[model samples]
Target chain A: MNVTTVFINALAAVCLVFALIKDTTKTKQALKIAIISFFRIFPTVLAIIIIIGLLSGFVPESQISKIVGENAGFRGVLTVAFLGAILHIPSLISFPLAASLLEKGASITSVAVFITTLTMIGMVTLPLEIRILGKKLALLRNGLSFIIAIIIGLIIGVIL
Target chain B: MKKMSKEKQKKGLVKDMLFLGIILAIAIILLLIFPEKKELVISSSKGFFMEMILILPAVMILMGLFAVFVPNDVIVKYLGRSSGIKGIFLAILMGAFPTGPLYVAFPIAAALLKKGARISNIIAFLSAWACIKIPQELVELQFLGLKFMITRLLLTILFVIVMGIVIEQIVLLSEKTTKHEQTS
Candidate 1:
């Protein structure tokens, strides 16, 4: 296993042990939550894995880079950002999907913006957010996030 | 309401399964047609599947721990009292701990508003909840590596803080004008 894998698993194990020591019932409850969520998200994860496979098998690297690579420019970046904003993929799944694209030839900018928008703005949840948080704040948050997501993507592109 | 959500959950699961079925069918058909590419597709998919399976349980465990240990009331208690720069940081920090989906945070944010928390803090809390959860960051680190994850994270925090203040100012300005009109 890689360092990232080891570190995260270690962190989780340590936390669970401490939690178990302090409160057995609560720790069991946490593990229950973990199992439920894991099963809940499993099907979606499989779908994403298959899609990544299809992408590598069928799609050409040239096409991926042309659409989202460094030379794809501002318009290309915006397209991915907009796609990210609208698509309802789980944020966890989006990382692997994103990494697949990056490995193929996608720009750091496109991937960055895509992930940022995917996590930050949810078009599907807008109405509920508005009803709860009000129209102004909801709209402003989404709108501003769209902008900042691009900015963040561009900055990451420059840095890395 | 409870029945409706359970129904929705059932529908969501059905939809997810249906989607997976369709994609799986398509993959099988395509593989049968282009047998040469089967190895390539399976290898790539397996690579990602392995990468994801390794860390996801860990991520979920962390999420579960946060959900049970860090109560929402605790968030409301601290975020309701703080103000200024520290409040902004605290809001982000608190947001990072909780592991629910973003929609879950809206009601909490609304309650904090009613509790007289600063608008900026509430905004910061919501945005941070969206992008900066701890488990989510670890997944990003695993997939995207440290430099990409850290840089994007720092940038997100910076802009989220700015957006919070900007939106609060606009809301306050509009409130002031409305109050002026009422007085007039």
Candidate 2:
């Protein structure tokens, strides 16, 4: 295993051990919590991953590259920003996808917008977020995130 | 209070279903519009299924475990206002620790906010760590040039800090307005 994986495993082990040592009841509670969290989040993650994979397969890299190329300009920036807002691919998938897009002649601006929006804006997770945080807070957070993503993309476009 | 909680829960369930339906419709449309070239379908299906199998279990278990183990008090203590720079520092630290996807982070972040984490800090914690994980950065730096990686990292940190402060102010103003409305 890589150093990162080893370190993560060690950390998880340490936490588990610490919880166990502290109290048997707490340990049981933690396990239950973990199980519940897993069930709640698993289906959504699975569905998202499948959709992203399908998207990558279906969309031609050439077409994606053309629309988001450096020359695509302001329109490209807006497209990247909006696409980022709408698509909720995990970072794990996004980095590779961005790299592929870059290879296909996509501009750094588009990639930057994609990365920024990949985390900040989330169309797929909007309902879940609204349920948890309420509509006002959810809308505010997402709205601000979308706006900031465009700004970041523009800055990156100019500087990098 | 009980009645209010029940009403909210009922509303939330409906919203969740609506959202799921929308996503499914979109997915179906995409699939139809881009019917896979037969040659590529096999490879794509294999990749898609493999990723689903691997990620689903891992993400679920991690989210559940994190939700249970990391208490509100601990999150608040580290990300809370009174914690100051130390809190921000700790928030960064926690963000560095590997977790599930961004969606999982949302529920936890919301929970932290309810428990008194500043909105700005939560935004910072989510955005910075969510996008530029340290471990991921290590791998990316090797391929993407360290200069690019470092520049991105530094800028993202700055962005998170500024955004956090802005969000906190917005939240505070909203809270005050709500309080005024309640009293009036």
RMSD of each: 2.2, 6.6
Residue lDDT tens for model 2, A20-63:
88776767776776665444534454455444455456677777
Report the TM-score of candidate 1, chain B only: 0.93
- Error of model 1, residue A49, in angstroms: 0.4
Q: What is the lDDT of residue A152 in candidate 1?
A: 94
lDDT score for residue B6 of model 2: 58
Cα DockQ of the candidate 2 complex:
0.30
**For model 2, what is the error of residue B172's alpha carbon versus the real structure, in angstroms, after optimal superposition?**
2.1
Candidate 2 clash pair list: A34-B64, A34-B65, A38-B60, B120-B164
Tens-place lDDT per residue, model 2, B1-184, is 7698558656755654566567667666776776754335335545545534443333333444555566545655566554577666567667655455566577667767776776666777777557656534643443344565676677666776777778778778987888653111
DockQ of each candidate relative to the true complex? 0.68, 0.30
| Candidate number achieving the greatest DockQ relative to the actual structure | 1
How many pairs of residues collide in each model?
A: 0, 4
For model 1 chain B, where is the 10-residue window of minimal lDDT? B175-184
What is the TM-score (0 to 1) of candidate 1?
A: 0.97
Q: Candidate 2, after superposition: displacement of residue B82 in Å? A: 3.8
- In candidate 2, residue B138 scores what lDDT? 45
